[model samples]
Target: MDIHGRQLQSAKQHQVFVNFRGDELRFGFVSHLVEALQRHQINVFIDKLERIGEDLTNLFVRIEESTIALVIFSRRYTESRWCLDELVKINQLTDQGLLKVIPIFFKVEPVTVKQLRGAFGDQFRDREWEYRCDKPRTERWRDALASVSCKIGLTFEKKSNESEFVKIIVKEVKKMVQPQENYVVVPFPGIRRRRDTSSHGRQCQEEQVVLSRESAVLVQENSKIANQIAVVSMRYMDIESENSVIRAQLGELSERLQSLNSIIEVVEGVVGKVPEIPEFLMNPWQIMSTSSQPITASADMFYYP
Candidate 1:
């Protein structure tokens, strides 16, 4: 329920968000798809727009803005952390009903991606070890992979014809991007003409106007509620941030306390072995012989400074 960061604003600009690994899909399959979509006048967003030091917030915004996402799952897709992160975000948007996802498995089986098997499994295992300390993130990545791979999508095998596949994918994308045509049902003209129903029609129109007004009021109320939710989410994020800081500080304090305890133990051990006073330190006029008496556990020499 708590939205943060990019969730502060709504995106209503782009049409399609292409989520793919640049190294594997950029030059070949994704390129062709982008060109085909562009040729058809579709507003497409690809990672090619990404630059050095570009804020990743832009990527999320683009994904949110897009009506549909084309997630091209390639063999090396999981190898790139950015790709995985994008996939997670895409899935999040999809779950929220903010975006539709059409996954395209390229040179990788849907089962392999879903189960993290074959080369996908290999890379995933390596990444798991690499991110062993961040298991939730890894798990989210895996979940995203499973979620997307299970969706109905086009698949391109290693030996599959690229051009033919691109054409099919383009056609599919076109179908998604195209607006649905509204069909009006016309009554048959063979029926006899009825008497004028002006009064009834006027009453129906009046009822429709009342309903429209009520709908508008409901919409406004919903908008207000959404705004209130956003404010609460921001507050929650601030609280979470403060909690994290407090936890970190507490951890530091706990470590410092342990260190102080160890230092105290060392000092105690050294002090417990109370040594006899040196004869040289005794007053010259009042020479004192070394004490033959054993020091007791309650000796004053054991007192701390």
Candidate 2:
């Protein structure tokens, strides 16, 4: 995949926009995050360039155009005046429902961002004093932070490993954006042709092509089904052959048992002992059909047939 081309397309396509301070995170955490997102085909616009006063308009346009914004609030995040300005614009887009903001508190507590405490508080104080002349403008930045801090977002703690934290972030981003490649879209030949049709003559020709393509597809599908049936039939034949062998073995064992019984009866007769013959050997069907006493051998019994 052409990552640079896709990133450019994404800038116009407005997939996901990332807002972060370059000084603290550009070479480290934010760079890794952008790379991970891009690997998944999730186009990202990482804010790595310096934001000049003249470029603020274009920057705001980019933020407004995006569908989702990722604002990484790091320790030195509040220190950048331009970063604060971007945050306010992002918040504005979020409030208007035009954009979705996902805040990432990197090694900083959400409350610290909300209340402007900890290192963030100290930086904001310095900026407040630096821009003390413009109290209202500074106040807007503080409000933006507070509002963004209250939002639901991912957090990377100081004790947590960066690589694992990035994976979790990417997973969450995937859930939110749900990249197109993750889904299967089966297009109908006719409908697809209709979409590509430019003129009446072209439409008719395309329709013919679509019909032929659909016919070929249907034939292929049927061939697959027939092959599957053939495989199943072969398996069934093998099972039937195995069953025939088992039955033949059982028949041989039954014949051997009958012969052994006949020899024992002959020995009993020679010894002047009458041996009882089971009714089943004589007539098993009769025993099943009628509820009567089974016929047995007696000393006077004789067969003259």
How much lDDT does each candidate structure score? Answer: 0.75, 0.75
What clash pairs does model 1 have? none
- How well does candidate 1 score on lDDT at residue 216? 51
What are the per-residue Cα lDDT tens digits for candidate 1 across 161-230? 9989988987888887776443211232443233334998556556655765676567546644543554
* Regions more than 4 Å wrong, model 1: 1-10, 183-305
Task: Please give, for residues 1-305, the per-residue lDDT of candidate 2 as tens digits.
Answer: 25643454455556688888889999999899889988998878865542655566577777766778899999998789989998989877665446677899999987777656678878987998999999888867866776677667988899999999999988888877775443322244434222333587566666666776677567546644543454355346548879999999999999999999999889888986765798686887766557667667886677565
Instruction: Report the C-alpha displacement of residue 200, candidate 2, in angstroms.
Output: 37
Least well predicted 10-residue stretch by lDDT in candidate 1: 183-192
- Please list all clashing residue pairs in model 2, or write none if there are none: none
- The model with the greatest TM-score is 1
